[model samples]
Target: MFKSGLAALIIVLLANAEAQFGVGPPFGVGPQFGVGPPFGSRPPAGFGLPSLHGDGFPGPHPRPHPFPNPRPLPPPRPLRPPRPLPPQPPQFSSLRLCTTTQLEQDKCLYALDIAGNNSIDLKLECVQTDSFDDCLQAVQTKEADLVVADEHEYLKARSADLVPLLYAHETLTSYYIAVAPKNITLLELSNATLDVNAMDERAFHAAALFNLHRGHDLCDQAAEGDVTIQIIDSADYDPTDDELLICADGSVLYAGDYDYSECNIDAGLELGIFAPRPYDTNRSFTRLLQNVFDTLINSLGQESEVWNFFSDFQGTSDVIFKNDTSGFSLIPVNRNGVTEQKFTSLHCDQVSLDH
Candidate 1:
């Protein structure tokens, strides 16, 4: 009777404990009735509410590392308008031309006057030198902006740093002519005496013609059966004194500008103009002068006042600014031609033998 009473009392105590803690193995085995993650235990992998750990599925949850939010970028500064550039300085207006000879000086002045009239912006000045050499020197030293020279002068000035800009066509024409005995054969003229008007003007062309005909050197001492070349003024030459006479067409033309058609002989070389190097860069100045020349040329056939200022004497005026030349043309300094080369060769150091 005493053992049965003790067992009943123990059973009643166990039942009351079950009612207090609910059904489960003691305090931490299996899931509790309605509680999550029973006590300190974890759910099975991938088999519970998401806990921000273990593949984001319900399972063991790890403490998440703290991360600060990134600071936003500063707003871009506003763009400013660009500053304006300064204006350029003004261009040169005055032009100085260096020339030789009274005719050329007068022509240059007259051309400048016409150009100045056409354009108020230009101011042309003239500096007259006694000779082509002086003109070239003035240009080289920058004492003068330009100098009008011939092919020979141009060639010489090239070594001195002179520049050839534009050709003053219909301005000046130099004709070299050879007047040999009409009936004498080249071989028979071996003993002939040749007279030249001016050594500087006619020597090369005359010698070239002589060489082309007789295949002899005009500069070397006359050999047996060779022609003797002599320099003399054309005005004093007599037909009986020399077998050959080399002269310029302008020399034959009368002072009043009349052509001596009877004196036409074998035609010769012609030389044009060579300007200073700076003229190549002075586009405005050259263009103005060129326009003035063009106007004068066009007015040649018409009854225009432009013709009155141009004193062309039988079209042989030595004035370059007037419309007297065949036409204007430009040749680069690098241009090479047989005729130009031949003419240039005659001026070589060997030319001293002619003296």
Candidate 2:
């Protein structure tokens, strides 16, 4: 038994010496236990052989080649010029000039601009319309600076504050004249059909003429003749040929004075330019226009044809805006207690022959 124990002890001591002399597993070895690849052998599936330097010991870790070929650095980008700023709008003094007729609008603006002589920069906004009501509305809404309209339109829109700046002086006075066979008296012509040049004007005049004799105002229903008043184009009709004709004193029929005589209907409204209420009065548009006219006259010289155009208007035709007529004078404000609607009966009942 002693001899067996001694042999077993010697075997144990040999194993311990071998382990201590570096002929055993590494200290605290983990789960990865394997022998390195043989020299010159391909590496394992994932791991690469360590890179070796001239020193012969395993040098450093093998770097991964992520791409087959690395691209060269891009050349430096070119410098760009800065962009330009946007343009600005031209500045000028602006004023709105309103007119009902195209001829008046264009000529007025041109004349005013010419009068300014480029010393006074004027940016004009023009509003041209066919209806007189629209022109008044434009001025009322402050869209227009000024307007030149007929007497009826002016009266319709006029208030205590509104006043006329200019009066288009008509040479011939307006008077309602009735022409019929010498046999018919004015009262007997009640149911008689009448032809007239201006339906609105003459109609009112007719009513007024009748009221003078009857001593009371006539409503539209009662004012109308017993027979339907046929609105005929008096331009084509001869006063002597028509059985009955009612027209203004200056109307075409008046040219044939031999055929017709005035019916003594003196009620008539003169045509004029009424400046829009307080704005026109307060802004002194009247003064401005007067100044413009004076300036034009002075700049063109008093003897220029332009002067004649303004001053030398004969009683031949209606005012021609193209001629730059400036002979307008202020008309006296005589409402004559007449309302604008008083003549609605004349125009409302008849088909608008003008349109």
Which candidate should be chosen as best, given TM-score against the real structure?
A: 1
lDDT tens readout by residue for model 1, 256-302:
33222333232233344445555566667566555534554554323
Question: For each candidate, C-alpha RMSD in Å?
Answer: 10.8, 16.9
Q: What is residue 303's positional error in candidate 1, in angstroms? A: 7.4
TM-score, structure 1 vs. true = 0.51
lDDT of 2 at 272: 57
What is the C-alpha local distance difference test score of each model? Answer: 0.51, 0.48
RMSD in Å for candidate 1, one decimal?
A: 10.8
Best by lDDT: 1
lDDT of 2 by residue, 226-310 (tens): 4433333233335554445434332333334433223233343445555555544444455565554444445443355443324
